[model samples]
Structure formats: C-alpha cells, structure tokens
Target: MRLALATAVVLSLFTSPTMAEPTVKLHAAGSLKAAMSDIADLYEKTHGVTVARAFGPSGLLRERIEGGEAAEVYASANMKHPTTLATAGKAGPVALFARNRLCALAQADLAVETETLLATLLDPQVRVGTSTPKADPAGDYAFQVFDKAEAFSSGATEALKAKAFQLTGGKDSAKAPEGRNPYGWVMESDKADLFLTYCTNAVLAQRDVPELKIVALPEALSVGANYGLTVVNDAPQAAWQLAVFILSPAGQEILASYGFTAAGAL
Candidate 1:
C-alpha cells in the first residue's frame, strides 16, 4: 500500500492543473510600463499565470537579450530593435503592435504650436529638451523629426540638435521622483521650457500636471513611432499567449485608451 500511494502522489504532481501554468518573463520598453503592467495584471487574473516584467529603454533591453539575459517576451518602442533581435537569432518574428507620434510638451504659458514650433525651438532664449539618441528610441525619433524640420528650413536639423537639451531619456537618465512623469518632472523642475516626446507620453504627463499642454507636430516635421512585440526564440507557451493577447481586440482597446494608435493608423 505504501508503494502504490507513493506512485499515485508522483502522478498527481505531474498532472495537477495548478502546476500546468508557466511564468513568463517580459522585457519591455520604458514607455510600455503603464499599459503593459495593466494588461499583464488582467491576463494573470483571467489565466492564472504570472508575468514578470522588466522595463527600460528598448535598445538597452535588446542588448541584454542579445547578451543572453533570460527573457520570454520583448516589446520595443520601435520595430527596428525587435527586428535586429530576430535577425541575430535571439527572438522570433516581430509584430508591429501599436504606433505613436512625436509632440511637444510645454509649460502652461509657453507659446508653442505647430505654426510657431520651429521658431520657438530656434530662439536662443527657449530651453528645448529631448531624449538621448541611440540609448532611447524616443530620442532617435526626436532627431528624425529634426531631420524633417530641415525640409521646412535649411539647416534646421543641426540647429535643433545644437539647442536641444538631453534631459530625461538616456543611458544614465536619473529616475524621476515617485509618481512623476520624467518629462513633466523636468519641466516642473525648470530644466526645460519645451520637451519633445511621444504624444502618449505627453498625454500621460498632462494627467499629472493639468497645466501642461501637448502641441501637435506638423506633418512636415512629424515622426511616426512603431511599437513592436516579439517572443524570444525559446520562450514558453505562456509568452506566446501573452503576445497573442496584446494583438487581440481587448489588448488593442487598452492601448487605444492610453493614447496609442492602431498599428497602421499612422
């Protein structure tokens, strides 16, 4: 009877429903923290699985993934980073999950709009801020917007780059005070008069400080940001399930609520 009981216990351990679920490790971009965290919580509540998340600049996270840090899912601020991972055999196929556009966040009284945008940044008295290039996709897109700015007026790219302050997003950007958006924090601390960042981020910051305004970028200088999602090459089944959920209507709805556009809506 002891031998039979021991055999039954071993079989039960293998077949238990509670033990069937797997915990997935998700490495995602900093901008995704809010939306992804909420989605993960909802997913766990409904599926009885857990999601472990690590958030940082997409490029830095991609480097870690390339270095073989154990992650099951990768969501990047831009499609290029995930595509690079897949090209290096570190991740699976890349999927464009959402899109964003660059906008200017300014003090309540700052005179900045699409019409006066370029002139304001060019003014020496105006303090312009942006993320750090290469280290963060937001910064890279900011610079790309500057490149487009060159079209409206010659040498606008170099001029904007020279005047823009690398304030919030960087390889060594300091953590903002708790419950504060980095851009808003910088603006509130008098570090910058205008900050160029994702439109979604601008909206989030406005929630923290109602006085902050989001100025739309003109079509000539607008830069579109594409968010990508991919599973690691050896990711568990749960990772793929989460990825599918993100692409599902429910997930898309959550993203839309957070100011993100449908993947092709740009």
Candidate 2:
C-alpha cells in the first residue's frame, strides 16, 4: 500500500502542468506584427507556451526595455537598436533576421511615378506622410531616401523633408480610428496624398484596400532596412527558443510570404 501511494505521487509530479514551458514576453517592431504573430501562434500550438507581445516602433520599444520594461525577446526594424541593447548588456548577440525596403503608398488615382518620384513629392499641391525620424526606423529610412533625392535636384532633400508630415507610425501616433486600418484611414481622410512606409506595410494596405496603389521607389532612391533580434539577458529559456525559431527555415518562409526578404537573401 505504501509503495503504490509513493508511485502515484511521483507520477503526479511528473505530469504537473508546471513542468511545461513558461510564457515568453516579446517586444517586437510594428512592421513585424503579422509575421511575428503567425510565428507566435505556431509556436504556442506546438510548444504549449504563450508569447505575449507588445508592438511599436523599434526605437521606442528599445527605449521602453532600457527604461526597465520587462520582456524576453526584442525584435527591431533595424540592426542598430538591437546592437545597442546587446552593447549595453541588456540582451544577447544580435542577428539580422529579415530585410525590407521603403516605398510610397497612395490612393489609386494618385499619379506617383518611379521616374519622377522626387518631383511628384515636391509638387506644391502634393502632401506627403512620413513616420517620425529618430523615433522610428521607417522614418529614418525615408530621410535616407530623401538624401538620395539630392542628386536629381539640389535642395530636394530638405524640401521634401520640410513638406513631409509626421502623420502616423510614430511612437505617439493616435489610436487608429476605430474599425479602420490606420494607414488606409489616414489616406482616405486626406491627411496626405501619399504615405512613405515599408514595402511590406504597403503590401498589407493594398491587400486590405485594393484601390490603394504601391509605388516602388527608384532603385537609387530606395533604402533597405535590416531587422535584428536578440533574447534579453535574463530571458526564460523559451525566449531563446523563439529567437532561434525566427531564424529557422520555417520562420523565414512566413516572413517571405509577408513581403519581407530573408536576411540571408539580402
């Protein structure tokens, strides 16, 4: 009778739910939402561990983590942010997980051409929307593209910069109007003639609003964004698992389907 009771107790301890993997806290960049969400879902289904996510501009997310916010994983839109964290001893080594490019998103009727993209942006009647620089890598990339515009016309860089409105994609952007896609809502509301954002985001917007057009930037005027990720220094073991999964072949497939290039491809 005593042996049987001890055997039952040992079995219960082995089967306890507490032995399962712990939930992972994930702080990811806004541009990676769809891909990361899909990966998290898949991971949860197979691993029995939840991934709690908080998405925002990479720079702001970094700021939060640096300001004592707790998260196990940090995925950034650019290499600099994650590298910064690792250098400060907050995270592990950074890895380039994905890549994207800057593009212009506009309503169907807007006439934005790759050949005259800078000229179109400079037109007095045209209003442009851009993310906030220093706070978001998308905005920083947009400014880099603007710098490339200088070859076509002197002062074109500053002129385009001055005219561009910091409408959305900022750390403090207004809650997207209820029931509306933030990108589409801003464009439909006439906030700007065109929005400069990631090619992946433009792809998503056009999928939701078929009438929206995605205008590719001229190759010379385009800037590629490198995405980086790292596990926080004190992260749970599951966090390291997730970081590895994102760099795995299956993870790269999901990101590719969402319009991002694998970091290895770039």
Candidate 3:
C-alpha cells in the first residue's frame, strides 16, 4: 500500500503543469523596433526570461503608460516623455540609451540637398510630411528643424509648419499595408513630396523604396534626438536587468548597427 501511494504521488507530480516563465513587458518607440527585437531575443536566450514588446510612437506609449497600461520598461524617442513619467512617480530614473538626428526623405524627382533643404521644404508647390506632434517625437524634431530655419529665413518656420502634413504617428493617420514601411508607403502613395523623420527611419524608408532620396539636414537646421529609457515603478528585477542590458555594450552595438548613436558614444 505504501509503494502504491508513492507511485501515485510521483505520477501526479509529473503530470502537473509547471509555473510559467517570468515575462518582462516592454513598451518602446517604433523606431527602436528592429534593434530592440534583436536585443530582446539575445536577452531571452541568455537569461531564459520572456520579453513581451510593444512598439509605437513614444508619446503615445507614454500616454498609455500614464493611463495605467502595464509596462515593465518604457523607451522613448525623447527624454521628455520618460522624464515626465519619472516626475509623476510612474517610472524610475530616466537614462539615455541612444541618440538620433533628423533627416529629410524626398521623392526621387525632388531636387533637394542639405544646402537647399529649407528652400525645398518651403516651396509653395511642395507637399511636406511630418509625424503628429505631441503624439510622436519625430514630429517634434521636425518642427525643431523648422525653428532653426527661422533664423536663416524670416517666416520660414511658419511657412514650413503650416504646409506640413501630419501623416504618420497620429490617432487618425492612415495605416500602411502590412509589411510596408509607413514613411515609404506614405511618400510612394503621393501623400507628400518630402517627409522629415529620424535618420534611422529615413534609412529604413529608403530601403523600402529604393529610389527614394534621403537628404541630410543642413548644419543650421540640424536637430539631434536623445532616446530615454526607464523601468516602471515596482517592476520585477528582470525588468531592471533588461534595462541594464539595453544600456550595455552589447545592446549599444546592435543599436549602432542600425544607425543609432549608442549611449556610450553619445
């Protein structure tokens, strides 16, 4: 009877379901998708923990976190969003993980260069595209470029802002077909002649549309972007570990390969 009872107990133990592995939820900017996905894969392989990732506009992600969405870590295109969360006690201290810069993605026929970027953008017939400001940091950076343009040519800022189309990264923005780059799709669809976005994004867009031209912003109108990262308050230790890995040399190397200026280099 004792032997039979012992066998039954062992059998039940073998049939019982094991506890689920720990998961870290990460909310990050859309621009970080490719690099972050790679980083997550490496971390999961090394630490044996699952990383659930969600990517979109940084500002929108911040709003979601603010509205009580569950996120272990938040990565933003600008420090302002994560810093705001830290200020509100929703997240931990903000840290700079990566850096980027603004560039112009222009249609093939448009004759634009760094020197003539301002004139090309301000041209009455040209249709300029930008991300939605306040909903996406890309738009804020584009507008910052416009602000710098004001110094070179009076009213340049107003002219550029008024004519720019808020195409992507907005609540009502048109959705790109699956497997399509949003910026490339928008430009290819004749939505805009020129679009201002992050240099990394512009590179991706160019990859999507081989003929598309990426024009560097002139020195006078240049805008540098700083990406911030933070873990939500009370998150598991694994979340902090993930954040640390993102700032580590291995992760920075991955980001740099994607055209981002790593935090260490920045």
- What tens-digit string does per-residue lDDT give for candidate 2 at 1-266? 22332243344344444444578899998889889999899888878889999988899999999999998889999989988998899877787889999999987788878887777888878898988887889999998988998998899898999999987767678657655566777777778888899999888777767788889999889899999888777665677667767877778888998999986421
Candidate 2 global CA lDDT score: 0.82
Q: Clashes in each model (backbone N, CA, C under 3 Å)?
A: 0, 0, 0
> How far in Å is the alpha carbon of 258 misplaced in model 2?
0.3
TM match of model 1 to true structure = 0.89
Off by over 4 Å in 1: 1-21, 264-266
Report how far residue 78 has shifted in candidate 2, in Å. Answer: 0.3
Model 3 CA lDDT for position 226: 95
Residue 138 lDDT in model 3?
Answer: 98
TM-score of every prediction relative to native: 0.89, 0.90, 0.91
Write candidate 1's Cα lDDT for 1-266 as tens digits. 22332243344345444333568798988888888888898888877789999998898898888888999888899989988987887776788888888999989889888889888888889988998888789999999988888877888889899998987667678778978887778887888899999998898888878899989987778899999888777565667667777776777878888988965321
Whole-model lDDT values for every prediction: 0.81, 0.82, 0.88
